[model samples]
Target: MARYDAIVVGAGFGGMGAAIQLDRLGLSDYVILEREADLGGTWHVNRYPGLAVDIASVTYSYSFEPNPYWSRLFAPGEELRRYAQHVAERYGLRRRMRFGTAVEQARWDADRRHWVVTTGSGELTARFLITATGFLSQPYTPPFPGIDGFTGRIVHTTAWPDDLDLTGQRVGVIGTGATAVQLVPELADVAAELTVFQRTPIWVVPKVDTPIPAAVQRLFAALPVTQRAARLANTAVLEAIMVAGVLEFTRAKVLNRGAGLLAKAHLRTSVRDPETRRALTPGYDFGCKRPTFSNRYFRVFNSAHVRLETGSIAEVTAGGIALADGSEVALDTLVLATGFDLWQANFPAITVRGRDGVDLGAWWRASRFQAYEGITVPRFPNFLSLNSPYSYSGLSYFTTVEAQMKHMGRLLGELARRGAATFEVTERANAEFLDRVTERLGTSVFYGGDCGSARSYYFDPHGEAALLRPTSTLNAHREAVRFPLDDYVYGGVPA
Candidate 1:
């Protein structure tokens, strides 16, 4: 029955950013509801072996607040958790956080001009609701037949147990995505027998991960600008690959081809056997799906104890797994490294009923997935979906967060100026934004490249790769700050 100015349905970086923006706008009476026992979102939830940021540590963090003391170029998962804690404490956000509270649904109440959010603990109302639940928050475990009958221990990477140990046990991993790539190597080192079931091969380039010396850390801490320069340099490289190579695929195809060749060369040198190498090599174009940087993933297959199985999974047996080719792999433990269910479980992580009882999930499924400026939507007054279509920009998630923060600032600033109780994007504006993004995507690899065989989660069930913004990071930033204010309709105040 409690009410506030706003309620953010996550505690991840995105939600943290939203809360920070709200505070800056003088709307500080907000609460952050987190499902887990702690903060850090993914960093708090995922604790599997070899968990680290794929993007370089220097660039992966917030441009405003840089962590100069990262142990390695790619900071470990623990470091990220610590960083999240540091940010929360620094921003005084801990007092506003409610842990162990999972939001079930949020509905707009037209009469009250507020949002009613239903959580496990109780219901709360707020003038505004921001769903910052990350895109990869939901873990997907493919329903292989007889999976329930499996007598052996079955675990998903997202829900990894703390006490569980794979040492000296026969283990089977059922994925080769980024998480699997990091985990398979660790499993091979301990598991007595290891079998990897890869449905689609992933494109991996060599990771230049090195330790940051103490002196370097001190220099970065003392000079701050030095870290900024390093971050800028790394951002440029990522932009070249994401913007130039992928987004501008038609004009800069050679760059994409060059990246593909580099991954191929890395694969060729890492694995000795031709057949194993071929099995590991991806057939799709580079940047069709998100790629990872790893020095150990391809080399792990060289171990005699590790076996790669590319056959279709028929079902899970009591002891192990059965392949469609009548082959069987017996194991003591089954690990489902399958990634997140984006379109189905995510997009709108929780049930959201907007104006006129329009369900967000059903509307996106029936039509195309979209959001105006990746924040607002038509018929969804005073709502901001941080993890929305065409929102993600560049390689680092911080880029996306900062851009959205700017968007929130502009929109809320206007609302305050107008003394409006509610603001909703017009349908015409939303359609125009969606159309512009879709047209621009025509030149991207998702539309022009051979992505059919890639099996990338980037493409939703409707076959629209609307996850990433087709524009450059700079452009996204510029547009966020300069979008037309008239696109949104403000109400609940005198003219």
Candidate 2:
């Protein structure tokens, strides 16, 4: 058994981020357990034809360690991989990473006030367990009747096999979510014919993407402060957009419709055929399910060879997909661009036994997965779930993660320094914390109060989601960065 001060699960941005923050605080006794061999989490896995980030490179990176080497305004998969590797090397994170070690379970031990963590290898004990298993880590594979019997190759966008070639073959992609928005364009040029099955139309913003000039890269590399300043300036602008989308934007769904007038112009501008352009147009508000920004996605439908079929998928046939409306589409290949099963797989394949041997998953399921500020759970001591709800939706995950991590770091450091054995939120404190989150979520557009007529995850699991921080970016920064520790009453075993 190897003893350690703390153990971080998953090597994604959140896990690596937590480890990096731990390093900055002069804490060395920790290890990062990664399920994969490489560092990049989602970027490492999803290598489909047209994969890139929706958030611009300006705000997608870390504030403390800015990468001066993004090839494009919106980075592709390759550039993102390089950036992650660069961060790992620069921060000395490579030596600390334990690859191919999947965490199976974690149990809280009341006697020692530590976590007994189980991985693929063996049991390891640590004072704390930080799970960075991202929201999109687990892919949701819907049951398709004849999926396995498909004569042609079948692949999910998340696990695209590099060997299979899409050239000249007829392809049918299921699900018109973020992944399909990118894939349709890339496959349109190669495949003889392509058809996209749209469960629902998603709002698409015109991505004003351009290659980064060499001179600009040199300028940022030479003057780091200027780059930081630019990031700050851009962050400030996006913050306003985040707030306006959540609350007081409009009285009815017409606000989003009127707001999409410019998007219509861009759609009409990129797509030539009036029918194709109208088919691509969305009747929903922006920011619903991570607003998609694309320049080529809209134009892909104008090629005359591609078609967007807005029908539900009934099942997969031996030859191809059968639509819910009794239509059969033939294809040589199928790609699942279906969105991830985030927030649903919050606890799976891992038995998290919290205080008194109570399972966190059962607790969350029974209580509807509510958390205290989306950070702390009521009974889980010295445990933190990274990038929890309400902390998301800003689009600038870098800023949001840093803010939350900073607050967690402060809590951890205070505990370590004071020799505190265990720390968990009290029942009253957890209730009050939820009050703030719910209040914040209510003010936002997600409560179905305004902005548009489209239903979004901002409402609930019943389509009435109650998530998102109500405060502005600056206010969120202040609260997350400089949160008061007094609200949390300290409790622990004797030193």
Candidate 3:
């Protein structure tokens, strides 16, 4: 069996970040396991049309390695993928990484004080395990009736084929999440007729996306500080929005009301049909669900060839989609904009057995998914999960990865300092952290608003919110840095 200091699963931003941290700590014996043939994780997998980042391009990159060559304010997926590859190649992570290796299961060996990971190729052991598999790694397609009967081409945004073409073909997209918002607009321009199936409406804000001028790019390249300033400026605006829209409900109510009004005005201007505008508008309060930004989304409905179906999908016929009203829409292609299983406990599709053979999935099923500072969980010795459970960053996902990677580095450092072979968060400490996290989460608009009834993944089946961290990004960063090592239990002989 191959052995290493640490084993990181998933080659996304989180996994790459973890690898970089390990390298910086001089622990060069770590390998990143990527399921796909290449790095960039989601960025490499998702290659749909009109796919661009919702966040500003300037702030989307790592704070340590800023990219000054971003073409637009909202960068497309390919650029981000290239950036990920660049980061890996620059840090010499590509050679050490094991691509096309999918981890099947990981079991903790109590006697050896290490993890035995089973993959497609063979078994590998590591003193420490890091799961950076990402939240949206698993794409979920709802089992609609007769969905298999559809002879037409079926596509999901997560696994978009490169050679697949929809030009001059009748296309139907089901679900109106973030991907649909960007895709429908692109499809409208090419497809002979585009039909959008919506079960619930999401809050749409204007995405003020613009190309970064060549001179500005040149300036950013000449003076790196200027790009940093731009990133900070964008960060400040996004932080303020998150604070107003979630952290402070009283303030959020006012701010979100104003934002909603602006969205309404945009909708009114874009969609002239009163019925279409009404159908697009969400009934729940803003911030109840994941809010999306798109300047062209609302305008897509204005196309004469585009049609939005608000009724429930009765079933999928061989010809096309059948509505509950006995109406059928013929289509040549079917695109399931259906999102991933965001809150599913069985993520990564890996069976992780901790001490006493405790299954991670069963544990989460029995109790609410809780983690110490969203990184380590009780009973999971020498394991850290990045961007999982409460570790999610509201303003930026990069913040979550940064903080967790830093914290994981600290844990590894402490292990080396004490010569301990194993470290796990104490049950008492995990419980105490949960007490505080749940209390703080209650104060957010997710609980105060009508989010419980909305089609949001933020709230779990038990009415508990576990998707995002309740505190501000700054607070999360500070907490990750200042977290006391005494909160965990370190064991085993000296390394």
Candidate 4:
């Protein structure tokens, strides 16, 4: 059995960031267990065509480790993967990582005051357990009737096979989310005929994608301050948009409408057919689901070779898909762009047994998934769930990571100061935090707007918005960093 001071599950951006933080704290006894053969998490796994970052490259990167060599404003998957590799190597995290290891279960040992984590290879005990498994770690595929009968090549965006070519083949892509928006345009030029099945229309604004000029890259490389300025500028713009789209401030509705008009104009300019444009427009609010950015997605609908199907899919036939109206579209290859199962499969998949055989998954289900400051739960001692419920404050996840690190860092510092073996947030503190967040969310666009009807994954099974934090990025950071330490019970087991 292997033992350490800490064990980070998953080697994605969150996991790598946590490992780097621990290393900075002079705590060398830690190991990163990654399920894949390599790092980069989503960037490494999803290799579908036209894979790229929707957010600006500058803002998407970590502030602690900035990359000035991004080839474009919005980076491709390969570039992001390279950035992850660079961060790992620069911070000396590659040596501490255990590749090709999947964590199966984690049980808290009350007497020992440690976590016994079971993996595919063996078990390891750690004083602290940090889950950086990520929200989109698991992929979801809808089960259509007669799907097994389909003889054609079928693939999900998350599990795209390498060397699988669709050139000149009749293809059909299901789901119109962010992934499908990027993919349809790329497939338009390759497939002989393309069919897009849309369950709900997504609002897509123009992506101002441009190559990073050589002079700009050189300037960024020469002076690091310029790169930092660019990152800040990009983050400010994203935050402004978030305030308009998600928050319900005095002028928020007006700003949201203005943004919607811009998206509508872009759609109109891209597609000539009024009927096609109407079919493509989203009925819900702009920020109901994650708004996407693309320059080629809308134009793909205007192409003579592409067709959009909005009717209900009655069933999937061996030859093709059959609609409820008895219409069938033949296809040689099918791709599912359906997103992920975060709350259902991803979070609950790991068997976490806390004190007295209490299951964390069952508790979350019964209480409608929550955490204290989106990091600590009541019964889970010396554990942190990074980027979990109500943790994400801004558009970019880097802010969330930084905020969580601040909170966790303070806790660790206090533990050392008191010479404590373990700590856990009190139930009162958790409930108070949840109450404050819920009160703020009640007035937010996600709660009062048409978001509930949009079927976005942001809302849980209980129709409560458990994904995004209701406050500004700065506010969330301040709360996490400076909140009262008395809200937690430190040292020894609970009575």
What TM-score would each prediction reach against the true structure?
0.99, 0.93, 0.98, 0.97
| C-alpha RMSD for every candidate | 1.1, 2.4, 1.3, 1.7
Instruction: For candidate 4, write residues 1-495 as lDDT tens digits.
Output: 777989999899999888887876766799999989899888999898999999999989888788889999999999999999999999999999999999999999998899999998889999899999888888887889999999898999988888989999999999999999989998998999999999899989989999999899999989989999999899888888886567763347887888789999999999999999999998888887888999999998888999999999999999999999999999999999988887774575577888787888778877778889988988888888885788888899888988888888888878767778898899999999999999888766677677644779888877888998888888888987798899898896322
- TM-score of candidate 3 on Cα atoms, chains taken together: 0.98
lDDT of 3: 0.86
Q: Please give the ranking of all candidate structures by lDDT, highest first, separated by commas.
A: 1, 4, 3, 2
Tens digit of per-residue lDDT, candidate 1, span 63-134: 888999999999999999999999999999999999999899999999999999999878999999999999
Q: List ranges where model 4 is wrong by over 4 Å.
A: 249-251, 493-495
For model 2, where is the 10-residue window of minimal lDDT? 246-255
Identify the candidate with maximal lDDT: 1
Assess candidate 4 and give its TM-score to the true structure: 0.97
Error of model 2, residue 140, in angstroms: 1.2
Number of colliding residue pairs in each model: 0, 7, 0, 0
* lDDT at position 258, candidate 4: 80
- In model 1, the clashing pairs are none
lDDT of 2 at 315: 81
Q: Please, what is the whole-model Cα lDDT of each candidate in the order they appear?
A: 0.94, 0.75, 0.86, 0.88
Please state the error at residue 195 of candidate 1 in Å. Answer: 0.3
Query: What are the per-residue Cα lDDT tens digits for candidate 2 across 1-495?
Result: 887778988887777888888877766789999888788898898899878887878789888878887888889988888888888898888898999998888999888888999987899988777778776677877787878888888788988888878899889988877788888889998999899987667777778889999999999899988788878787765765676654434443455445466677778788878766666666655655456778888878877778888777788888888988999999999888876665454543366888899887677656655665566676788887774555664667776677767777778767767766777767886777667766655544565543354545454453435456556656666776565665455667533
Give lDDT: candidate 2, residue 479. 71
